[model samples]
Target: MERIEVIFKQIGTALRIIFLYKIVFLIACFSITTGWAKTITVCNTCDIASLKKAIAVAEAEDTIFIKKGTYKEFNIVVDKPLTIKGENFPVIDGEDQGEIIRITSDNVTIDGLFIINVGTSYTSDHAAIRVVKSEKFLIQNVVLEKLFFGIYLEKSNNGKVYHNKIIGDAQDEYNSGNGIQLWYCKNVIVGRNIVQKTRDGIYLEFSDNITIDNNISTENLRYGLHFMFSNDDVYTNNTFENNGAGVAVMFSKRIKMLNNTFHKNWGTAAFGLLLKEINDAEISGNTFEENTVGINIEGSNRITYHKNNFIRNGYAIKVLGACYTNVFEYNNFLYNSFDISYNSRINDNVFANNYWSSYTGYDLDRDGIGDIPYRPVKLFSYIVNRTPETIILMRSLFIDIIDFSEKVSPVFTPDNLVDERPKMKKIK
Candidate 1:
């Protein structure tokens, strides 16, 4: 019985030793597979000559290097997790055929590529690079020109799009698309991009928790940055200039726009910033320069506008209707034709501690605050709202006399609309 027990113990020891060796072998194989991942090179003279062929044979988490040459490819779908890096800004011309690159998988990175000529289609929203339902993606250092839609993100999240240049030649709105558009996306960072001459430079629809900073969007056919139903988004240090309508924030809540520059957006319906149906937002430290209207507000409520500089605009702030509980303080309204134009006679908004360049009131006590209340709404502006043709008499002396009379007696404009504590000097 003792000899039988010894044989059984020897068999158990051998089985344990075999199991340990098998585990070590499996770990070693995994390490080799991870450390020696394949890199497919695509060029005119290479084993993998085309991007499509390289992607077809590439394993998961492989790297694909594209050489510096024009690859006329369209509808190139990236359905696997890979890294595509360009050697010297390789051109990916779509030949005006269709969509350029579509990414459907997660954990993808595309860098240093110049994509152009995305075909225009009324039925399909083609894009230079469309990231659809992907996560943990990075699309950076890319240049897109003559495209329909540049970097369109649809239902994608956790992505970064940085340092991309999108220059579109859009003549009209119907035939054009947006530069950087995010639809139903979240947790995305769009920074350091230059988008010009598109329908809308940066457009967000139903997107949340987005950060758009350090971007220059100018010369677009429509609004430079257009937000619709997007909430909890912050856009700071961006420049929107010379667009059809500068920046339109509509139907959005809890949005913060800080330290942005809106300049030189002039048209019949142009404005530096248009807020329609927006609520609970903050606009601070912004500059509105040389725009037709500094801000065109309509049906917005509970917004705070502070420390903004409105310079040389046609109307500094045009309050159309149904805007209430809006606070405007520490703002510099300089050289505006009309400081504030109110369409309604009832005023529930607050405007205080603002520096008006046209304020002629003298401070006897020299406390840097005007003792007399400054009425910003003018009767001539009210008449101009009714009859836009009367704007020709804006600089006439007769128009000034009527505006002065309306200030003394609150008949045509809102009586309660006054800046009681107006600043004597310009706001720094």
Candidate 2:
């Protein structure tokens, strides 16, 4: 019995020794396969002075730390996974030649770089930084100036663009490009960016599942934020101000726009928000102040506009035609030239629980609901739509008399468009 016990103990000891050897062998193989990632410094007096040279010799998953100096290089391609970091925001002056950086590999990050003077080309859209078909990429804390297109993302997904400032000196829309453009991208987040003076501040085309939050888009020559054929996107807490037009969401469905401010976007053909061919959208908690038109709707259906404040606008909500099943509830319309303007006599929308500053109806029930229904559509607005020159007499007593008569017996505007449960006070 003693001899058998010794034999079993020796067998167990041999198995333990073999397991330890296997672990050591696996560690050696891993070390050989993935060499340690190293940092390559680029400076004027360093061995690698130029950014192109640093990138040429860099292995995958390496860090290229560029010191503070001007690098006059263009069309620099990043074809491997590398983090190109700049200290004190190094300047990459393209000298009006071509694109500054083009990222084509996955898991690449471009941080703390100031890029300028991207080439202008009518045939191709030149950009300061362009990410093409890259995934898991990050572009943050970068400044772009004097660029044709500031940061362009083409067919890229699962990326983030954060805290970048893009300033352009765009004079015309025909020759200028957008600040940050996303084409055919999905699952991208654009946050905390300030884009100004571009043709369009931020433009998205054919992109889906995008989150655009906390962005300030101002002073653009065209729309501050333009969306075309992009669906299932949400833009929240953004401020669009002083642009030619605030925002245009066209041919998109299932969009959620919440807590955004649109202010001072005034022009003859300007509006705070334009919705065309949009469906199943939610627009809530927005403030539109001092704009030509607060919201312009055309051929949109199944949208909900709730908890919005439209103050001191030329027209609060202008319904062109073919808008159906839309609900405007719990909104405050204050001191507008015209509260609602409908070009069509047919209305299939619901207006409920809204507060109008011009409402004279009494609330006898004391339940915070007005006793009488308020009709928002005025006859003068309809006349002005047909003969825009008649808008000159908007404040005249003659226009007021005609508007009172139409309220009694509606003829030009949609008769069914009345807030049944009008709120006595403004919604908080």
Candidate 3:
């Protein structure tokens, strides 16, 4: 009977210990969900003078407010879920040491800070801010300058980068990095950012489901916006101007490029837009102006070019090879040196209902369409393809005679490559 009494006493102690554990867990969860989350302030005269120290003692869901001062720190890592905000635009100077702020946790937020002087490394991609393998992160209202890379997201998902300005004084492409770069990231929204003088203003590789909207990327050494191996991305209301080769989309599929402007991208090899090996894309309502070549397409297929305006370019569209099933319709080609240049003799793409300023055909019945078919590819363009130095005689009367002869006999240019229903008036 004494042994039975001892066994019952042991059972009672175990039950009491379990009850105490439940109470402790409930209190810890309540601190996170209720109003128990703390706010830590970092200032020059405070107890926590350093941002690194405030992050050290901060709990999950705490906010760290940084006051107005210059903090000479680098390699600061945020490994917990916290909100870091600057009160009066505090400056975080990296002194060209390394990456400034690196976030490795989910639900992290960084806002209203000015970061500069990121270290340049050939082996490592140092950035002013780097978010790696994190989800639902927000980096907004920051300014970055003198950067190797401004904001880089690697393997991150469901993030938003908004209202940031990144300025880089990049002279060459060998050492310069992109302003905003995403690698293997998905479902990211990048908006209202101004990026200039980087290698490529905004770059993406192996990323998907990204929306890049309302951004201005210009004056870079390479492309203003570039993407490769990315799919299901949408870029709208962006302006890409004065870059080396404006924008290049290679090896991508299902991309929607709408309502963007590509202007003043001029060089010997520069173009407003370059599409290489891309398929099933939509290029609509965009403006390509004053470029050497408006759009250079190579090995791209099934893209719909609709309602775009190509103005004052050397060649409005230059097709290299293996481009098939692409539809060009309802677009305006105005004051271009050449409307279209095709290298191959076979014509597999469709060009219909486009307005050409060089079209001299008459509409006899006034049905809002030209009665004669418009041959976009001229024979001089074919000769310029073989001998580029012959472009000096582009405006001479001799070149015009040969182009008319080729139109009459259909010798060098593709005979079937003609717009049957050319629009009599410009497309609105």
Q: How would you encode candidate 2's per-residue C-alpha lDDT over 22-103 as one tens digit per residue? A: 9999988887788867899998889999889999999999999999999899999999999999999999999999888999
Model 3 C-alpha lDDT per residue in residues 1-428, reported as the tens digit of each score: 99999999999999999999999999999976785879999998899988999999999889999999988999999999999999878999999998999999999999999999999999999999999999999999999999999999999999999999999999989999999999999999999999999999999999999999999999999999999999999999999999999899999999999999999999988999999999999999999999999999999999999999999999999999999999999999999999999999999999999999988899999999999899999999999998999999998999999989988788899999999999999999
What is the alpha-carbon lDDT for the whole of candidate 2? 0.95
lDDT of 3 at 297: 99
Clashing pairs in 2: none
lDDT scores for all predictions?
0.94, 0.95, 0.95
| Inter-residue clash pairs, candidate 3 | none
Write model 1 residue lDDT over 1-428, tens digit each, in one string. 99999999999999999999999999889978776567888997888777888889987799999999989899999999999999999999998998999999999999999999999999999999999999989999999999999999999999999999999999989989999999999999999999999999999999999999999999999999999999999999999999998899999999999999999999888999999999999999999999999999999999999999999999999999999999999999999999999888888999999999989998999999999999998898899999999999878999888888888887988889999999999989
